[model samples]
Target: MRDRKIYILLTDTGTVLTRMIRLYTKKNYNHASLSLDSNLEEVYSFGRKRPRNPFIGGFVKEDITNGLLHNAECVIYSCTISQKQYEEIQAFLNEIESHEHSYRYNLLGLFAFMLKKEIRRKNAYFCSEFVATALTKGEIVQLRKPPSFVAPHDFEEVGDFQLEYRGKLASFYHNKNHSYQLSLSS
Candidate 1:
């Protein structure tokens, strides 16, 4: 069986919410998004549904090349997964995307995490929680704690993901005219 790659993007968007999160997590990148492709065409996360409003957030297909993530500093990591795992992830994302309106950002869950508690909402997730849950549901990785308890830094501890790129999100764009390769592995 062949293997496929999935990208995990950890970013610091410098938003008020992210800044607040940083005060607690003390992590450089406070947000996490999962990308199905290296080019980041299929990035999914639970974040600001609108660039101007962080409160009205939910299952969002982020545009890393524009809006909040464009100027953000990020770390990209890639993990190898079996074809079956890829399909499982795709199916899970597709199901949620199909009912995206029902989903909402798990703001309460995010707060509960600070106190070492988990809040299992019906259809909601914070950024890292969403990514962690998706990866777990795909059978790509098993986390020591629940997804709600997972933070951006925990991804590194739990998975065999290789560091791929580290720089401004704008520089990471893959286009015809330009490309950036600040490979940490090299």
Candidate 2:
């Protein structure tokens, strides 16, 4: 059977909230998302439900073509997983999406992480925490620490992920399409 790939997207959107997070973490990317496809057509994250309002947040199916990710800087990493693991991930995400209203962004958990504490809220999660939990639930990666403690940078350090791309989030699609066109013409 062929192995399937999942993507980890680390982004720095340079929003006011992201700027505040940068002050604390001093990291290049302050947000993370998981994508089921290399084209990033199926991306998920715990972030603002509305681009203009950062207050209302939950599990979101991200649209990279607009909003915060439109011009964001990002790094994409791909991890190979068995078909069984891929199916597990799909089922997990589907379950969450089906009851999306029950989930909320873990604001308190984020603060707990800053305080070096683990707060696993029943159905809430911050971006990286959610991504880590998803991968763990899929049986693809084992976490040395609690999912609540996982950060965007930590995925790079822990997983056997391959660096897929680095540059603007918008440009990823542009470049991918450009490269495909180049190959097609050759």
**4, model 2: CA deviation in Å?**
0.4
Model 2 regions lying over 4 Å from their true place: 179-186
List model 1 lDDT by residue over 1-186, tens digit each.
Answer: 899999999999999988999999998999999988878877899999889988899999998768999899988899999999999999999999999999999999998999898789999999999998899899888788899999998776654898988878877774312663435732
Candidate 1, residue 13: the lDDT equals 92
What does candidate 1 score on TM? 0.94
What is model 1's C-alpha RMSD? 1.8
RMSD each, Å: 1.8, 3.2
Clashes, model 1: 0
The lDDT for every candidate, in the order shown, is 0.88, 0.88
